[model samples]
Target chain A: MERPEAPEGAVWAEHVAPDGYTHRVLARGTVFRLANPEGGACAHVLLHHVDQPWERLNVADTVKVQWNAYGGHLLLSDQGRVLASVESESGYDALCGTTPKGRDMFVRAAAKHGLGKRDLPPSLSFFQGARVRPDGSLHFTGPAGDVVTLRAELPLVVLIANTAHPLDPDGACTRLEVTAWRDQPTGPDDPLWTATPEGRRAFENTHEYLSARGSA
Target chain B: MTVVAANAGWSALIGAGQTLTIVDLEGNQAVDFLVYSAADTAERYSAQDTITAQGNIFLTTGSVLMSNERNPLMTVVEDTCGRHDTIGGACSKESNTLRYGHHTRPQHACVENFLAEGAKWGLGKRDLVSNVNWYMNVPVEQDGTLGIVDGISSPGLKVVLRAEVDVIVLVSNCPQVNNPCNGFNPTPVRLEVA
Candidate 1:
């Protein structure tokens, strides 16, 4: 797979092969981008708060609050905190969780890294499509190769696994390219600096926690 | 190896042939659990496989946790808490609001606990699964309905599992306060491995 050019000013970048995984700790205000360079790849992503490690991204909350599962949304933390804002050009799958086929490949890849099951979490199936039918069954869809960019709301520890979605017809995997760069400072008028009512409250709560810990 | 606080999360990697015991230091604390293959993230615990193989929904002594691939990951070697829930999934802020009210939204839940603890090991929300609710009481009614009720366990009750493969175990000392599942209060639990 050919490597995609990193965004200008990118501080670091890496390409994850099929069935590979990578973990990184990103600073707040960083723009982290994951792109399926060869198409037909799924990058399962997870995030956690750097200071309060227990407050991590809540995928279910992300869907419930938005009332939609499509891409281009804010991923919320369990405390209603904004972990990251997701902007995807290729879309994501909301109905399907990680499948046995994907898990098998991840296991093989993890073994090479000396990581155990504790290191494996379910994924937010990126660049894949599936919908829940009225009858409760799922219908898989295709057309991969989307770039998903996440702008961090807080310092985060992120994990991404590159693998095939269960619904992929050929079960084939492709390479995933990741680019991370410090985002330009946002002014008060910038959307990134604005918050929803709930988000504002969450931010306040986080501030309180930090203040209590003498870290604010 | 760890003593998880009430409403907290804990995680560990248990190799093949190792046994891990969870002690309910205080009775009635629901311990939410998820397990994955140490070597493969995808080959994790499957509630469907375990339920199908056992022909039962409750986990107990001798019950083997089957992965999504229908392979055994861990076997329940001993149990003082006679039954554990296989379907009462980890609690989350969403579920708390849906089941109780919006007022419960700010409360910490099992999902947060799992994510927080699992993150230390590089695990995330995408890795959560239909977990085992150790010490939780979810009784299935004759009409196929399920009820999360007061637990039957007493203080010091324990359950043990022997890993069939190298596996990672993630746990949440369930912080649910909206229901009787945790007796309206969450408490600490003890974890020991041999």
Candidate 2:
């Protein structure tokens, strides 16, 4: 008998967070040990908010959480269904402040990550423009330079764009991790994505950002 | 090693074996993408299929990514580094307010760049789903957890992908500096495909 190969295409590596930094999963737990030196010191810690299944949030409920400019994590799970997004901030505090105001920032960021700017209330202000690639990597630079590469899974894989540095020796990259469940479990179209205002906002953001851009 | 160019006002086609590259000429950027079937739009990129086929969270070289209609969109033909985040999702206004503060809610995000460039293409919300963060490192713990870590890529690193079929690409250079994913300092990147 052979042990099953871990989920295919799973990634594993260290990560940063708010409370402190942990090289752990982008979801639960914290901290992961790096196998080499270039991996950097595992010191940056960020905060995360895991949605409670028992909580039944409806559109009437105040949008409980959002992730605006700061960098943080958001996971949407309903048994097998799930949707997750990460927010990037300009200032550290703006990313994961604990104060009600801090959490609000995450909520806003989450909103922007999940829903589109138009979905925001008049009272809610917003800025836009982040890029994502078909390979699942986001592009924040421009049309002809280095690109940051991001992926979701155990030991997640992040690649540098253009030059094949330590990350890409041949200037091309392709690896597989087996940690993620093969079954999609759930998707953005699922009702679970927008049961509450917050969820609706997230779904809205997802819809807006994930669409294709046309020639201007 | 190979380069592909998309004129500001135009688009190009990338066939299988022909990998398309998007570069962040500067730094600290994000790219938005839409994967459509060379045959039909109805069979577009399905984040669900991509995840299910890969059986993992993040994507990288060697990962044969699938589309919504169960078609292979693009294969991770080559990757410099080895970490990517599939669950971290993207940036937006609502997320800005929720993650930062209501005061910072108006800050620019990825969705804006996507729509600003995508609106004319006839793409809409119905086309959104699971996306891959190329340089981003969102790790999972032994107990099944996740978090964003520093990027595995440095300046000039590239992730190469071969289109299984003709696929359209959209990108937004990320402008976020608050997180370590960009070392708290969002920088520019370069894109080249041939």
Return the top candidate by lDDT. Answer: 1
Q: Name the candidate that leads on TM-score.
A: 1
Candidate closest to the true structure, highest DockQ: 1
Tens digit per residue, CA lDDT, model 1, B49-86: 57546655578988999887779999999999888876
Off by over 4 Å in 2: A1-216, B1-13, B23-32
Candidate 1: stretches off by over 4 Å:
A1-3, A51-55, A99-116, A184-198, A203-216, B1-194
lDDT of every model, 2 decimals:
0.71, 0.39
Q: All candidates' TM-scores?
A: 0.55, 0.46
Model 1 RMSD, rounded to 1 decimal:
9.0
DockQ for all models, in order?
Answer: 0.07, 0.03
Q: Candidate 2 chain B — worst ten consecutive residues by lDDT sum?
A: B1-10
- Residue A118 of model 1, lDDT score: 42
DockQ for candidate 2, C-alpha atoms: 0.03
Instruction: Give candidate 2's error at residue B22 in angstroms.
Output: 3.9
